[model samples]
Target: MRPINEIIVHCTATPEGRPVSVAEIDAWHRARGWSGIGYHRVIDITGARLAGRPLSAVGAHCAGHNTGTIGVVYVGGLAADGRTPKDTRTPAQRRALAAELMELRDRFNIRKISGHNEYAAKACPSFDASAEYDHLFEGRERLFKPIVDHLLQRGDAGQFAQSWRDQLITWRENRNQPSPLLSSQDPDDLFGHAVEAETLAFQRERQIVADGVVGPQTRNEMRLALNGRPPFSALENYQR
Candidate 1:
């Protein structure tokens, strides 16, 4: 056990939905003068998980933070059409992905799950895990609704979770960045309201009275979530 701490999700930037070989990934990394594939596993459309990097080492998938994370890539089905419907992670692949994640979750004591796009700001997965990944496990949406809502508000929470959010916040603070916070009054637009809604939902779901406010309780959940210990409330009514 090399003390794995994080699991970062990604999509092959390629157009095809086929399984990729280890050699191909290796060569891709080598060509960039990197050590190896930036992911620990690559899940093809058929649900096969191919190991990319060794467990002992960190990957290079996410730009800012890869030293403590495990990267997993999936074959992408996203088309150039710009609509997300055409891109889907096959059920078999999703199932395999879930199983693989569970194994890693147990092995490494990981608690949080995230997509690549969230970390550095690239939509490699092309689909929203918050929006698309819940169906694989029934009633999962309710489990992740708060987290998902918060992430959705940022338009990149599916990928970043909290680690990158903290990083982004740090970046903003360092640069004296003003909040690009969107308007939250309109329920329909609810633009940039994911974090707020999610925090509130999480608190309320935890029987803490979800005020839709991001206070200490919500921040604590986010912290624990990044480490993979989602609140028990999230597991309720969730399909295994």
Candidate 2:
């Protein structure tokens, strides 16, 4: 393995919840007249890590820091409307990113890590990765929290919220866990009392804050437990 000095984190700058892959990035880079994908690795929203440029070769991610720095980009940096910069990482992405960073640090003895914004005036990552991951050097286990897109609660009905509730139900059922929130016959998407109860129970079981709200932490933990499978692959596939 090539000796690396710094690890730079970046974002794909796509809309929130958008799914991107290394192949797509490779084509984009090729269009830009670069060899291929600039980053060494790209982590999709579902937490799937895809290999990009070879680690043995120099990176083209940063302007001046390519020689000794490895670039890692996560999909999704834009807000819901897909224009504004935002920290749009999902729970799965958070865990996978933390793990990948830790692995890189250990494997390469990397001492410095920063977001793409730290070097350039642009907000590529759209979050302070250095400060957010500062706990890693202090032996912190899990460093960052999930990026909450919305809060799912009683009477708050929407396709996104409903999809989250449905995901919660699917994750619970798949794990062979019984939840009153789920219907015995079919999957339900309503955010009802049972959903709140199950959400609290899930949170408590995972030692998360039992606030009964599908906030960042709760969403993160749930997706982590679910093993970060693509929550809506069908929709994503259809879009593709």
Candidate 3:
């Protein structure tokens, strides 16, 4: 794993109460010719923790400061008008964000927690993340294992399954290749035939083993597809 020392927070810049999926963000970044989503993690309106770029890779969220930093984004920053910046974090989002920051701080021994506004001339994140989370750096116990570690396959249900399905659906939409199977499914929490078929299709497209199961390799490839490959040359410069 790459050494990490900082966590930078950002906002999706979407209007309040608007739901933004991790895949949608990835598609946006990809439209800019980037590999995928710039942040490493995303917190949705319902406080769902969505994965973005892998922790081992450098993020594209910050210019000239991507190295050794993990990028985290919450789903909303814009007010109802969608023009002005605001602290639109829901109560659940606030709790979730604090928990996530504490976990990362302990897990990575992070030294800093900052907002995008601190680094650029933008009102991203819409709040003082550094000041809010300054106490996280005091000290804490670390977790020995990652938060989630289970292969998503047919018959699985709940938040993780739903999150992955959301990502798959968004990716297909972004590619302008909508999946009829996925479209017909409601609730989107169950890993049924539609999800399995789409998973198989994605694996084939990525040229990985088409097992139709979301294992470690498949998950990594999904992230790679979203973020593109790591810029080794740029990382080398940052390291030096």
Candidate 4:
């Protein structure tokens, strides 16, 4: 309701295998003479996402940036020794967190997602979240047409079928050294050998067949690799 724009992840800093609940977190905050839990949500060891503070109110999780952001706190962040900071998220928690974040992005039009360590030095989440999950923030769309549609059945020369070539070039180039020029110059058609080679290389990198054809399989693999970003409205068309 406060025009949420960012989703921040945090850790409870508790030791691995320890069980903590939202009720306990609420009591902790109440003891401090504040509202209930500071975060909008809490994820437990088994990856159960629970509600905490209401979305209608400003959160108390992050120090200075709580006004326009949502906070998600996982139960564990410490190592087995219970002192050293470590990413102790379980596999279930990882999946649950991704799903929860996706839902939040769709509902609140979230633009950016980051870990607590990005804003503070304490390594609250104990991992480089932004770098690791960068692909998830890239808005990747599935190709509506098959790659073979653009290729000439008899010869290698053909018009391109994909309009996402520009986006693909941008995405792939950002991952590696700048090519000075993109392999695909035409946004609407495949017109260059460099583009074909680049497509082949991308297929190889994704472990798919290196046929240099951007077909359904290639498009699916690309979508998976990109993981997509928040909805377009979340960043550009957001009314707030």
Cα lDDT tens digits, model 4, 37-153, are 778888899999888777665566775567677889989999989999989999999998888888887887666778888777888988877666656656521221111112321
Runs of candidate 2 with Cα error greater than 4 angstroms are 138-240
Position 166, candidate 2: lDDT: 73
**Model 3: lDDT to the true structure:** 0.77
lDDT of 1 by residue, 1-240 (tens): 444555777876665554566667666765553444667787876787776666665455775556566787777656644334234578887788788877776677665566666665667676665344433334422433211212233343443344434433443344465335422232222224554644444455444435554433345454554454644231123222
Off by over 4 Å in 1: 80-86, 130-240
Q: What is the C-alpha RMSD of each candidate to the true structure, in Å?
A: 15.4, 19.6, 16.9, 17.6
Backbone collisions counted per model: 12, 0, 5, 1
RMSD of 1: 15.4
For candidate 1, report its TM-score: 0.51
Report model 3's TM-score to 2 decimal places.
Answer: 0.59
Better of 3 and 4 by lDDT: 3
Where in model 4 is the C-alpha error above 4 Å?
Answer: 139-240
Q: Order of all candidates by TM-score, from best down to worst?
A: 3, 2, 4, 1
Q: State the TM-score for model 2.
A: 0.57
What lDDT does each candidate get?
A: 0.55, 0.73, 0.77, 0.67
TM-scores for all predictions: 0.51, 0.57, 0.59, 0.56
